[model samples]
Target: MEKTLKRLSSIRTESDILREFLAEFLGTLTFVCIGCSANAVMLQMPELSLINGPLSWGLALSVSIYVSGGVSGGHLNPAVSLGLASIGKLQWKKLLHYFLGQYLGAFVGSLLAYAIYNQTIDRMPNDITWPIFGTKSASHINAGSAFLDQIISTMFFLMIICSLTDEDNPMKPSKGLLPFAIGFINFGSMIASFSYNCGGALNPARDLMPRIMTAIFGWKSAPFAYNDYNYFWIPIVACHLGGILGCWIYRLMIGNHWK
Candidate 1:
């Protein structure tokens, strides 16, 4: 009994919690930096076609998950965390800690992207490059359209995530494929909607942190900064809602036998 008690106490130490929290922070920071930095570089590369954006983001996200999944569960997105919590897959006590870590990690990642691209950004004329970094403007989209696009894209993304991670599904084959599945979903969503609306940023971390970085870097001079940027919270909120809805839909359709 004493040995068992010692083992349990060792698992619950402050150091263990801190290590997990730091892992979450670093994992999320790396994900955002790689994914969004790729986007920024793609925008600045005159030789490269804009057509490669979706594939680039998908590759980055996939690689990040493969590298970080063991330590942090690879939940680099707030919506993913919320979805897991809603389904009782995550501990409620850790929710806020995870969220704070994700947000701070993303902010750091965006700042790094800004630094890496600072020279290229300065060289480009404001007219040609501002829109690429900034959020979609009201002039670029209506509130209704933006909201619907976010909801639909997030729903699809969440469904794919839940399905891939569902262990009980005999058809799922193995956990080895989850990273590829997630990457493909991101790729599909970006290809299907990024051109029509910039807010198709299905990952809230991908959108909000970059926007915050943009503001900090004085990209607020960019068109639609104040007008459209104010609507940024909608996508964040909608994505969470869509994730919850997607989980419910998955349970209904797939039948949650795979507890």
Candidate 2:
């Protein structure tokens, strides 16, 4: 325990921060690439169900966690980062670096996915393009409900993540199992978001950055056109709020017991 704390605390050097940023960037890139590419392919196919996107995202994120868990704790999602920081697994001072790396990485990943399937997109009509990249609230669901949907989804996700990574938790899984557990529940979370039509975007970087890419590259109104409200803010803002709440809940329910 002492050695682990020492090593974690020792990462205060400039080079270390830069390395951590790069790891986060690359990890997020890997996650968004595989996850969103799968969504794009499925969206273009038309015959497939929406469930496929969540499956792909969950599996892709599992791989992302495996790839980057060692260096940066595999915080491919901003909500995950916020949860970790809230619980003291991450330092608050370096959050800006992590957020920047994650957003940039997500942007690049969205561009890469677009490039890979741009041929089909260019030939396709504009109407179908938005659903491929950005998410929306279901027509029947109001914007407020959609906002709550995101909060609940991210809140559950972060709590599970905190529990899995908590060293003091008896129910915590081994390192190898952590990714799968997170991935599996992430799949569940996406299914939960289906009713709201937010596509279970528990991560701001995952939702907003790609939405930005779509908006800039001709899909100007796609990201915010859902319902009577601009649905873009729901995932980005609500997820952060939910993430903080989740960690606090975990600390209250389980983490504090160690003391």
How much lDDT does each candidate structure score? 0.69, 0.81
TM-score of 1: 0.83
**Which regions of candidate 2 are displaced past 4 Å?**
1-14, 189-196
Which lDDT value does model 1 have at 210? 69
| Among all candidates shown, the one with the greatest lDDT | 2
Least accurate 10 contiguous residues by lDDT in model 2: 189-198
Steric collisions counted per model: 0, 0
What tens-digit string does per-residue lDDT give for candidate 1 at 85-201?
Answer: 888877777777778777787878777877887788778776455444434634567777777777777787887787777777666636566777777778776544554664357
RMSD, candidate 1, Å? 6.3
Residue 36 C-alpha lDDT in model 1: 62
Cα lDDT tens digits, model 2, 113-231, are 88898888878776567656666676677778888888887888888888888888888999989988888878865554543456778899988898889888887775666554467
Clashes of 2: 0
> What are the runs in model 1 whose C-alpha is more than 4 Å off?
1-16, 46-50, 125-134, 137-140, 189-195, 221-230, 257-259
Error of 1 at 175 (Å): 2.8
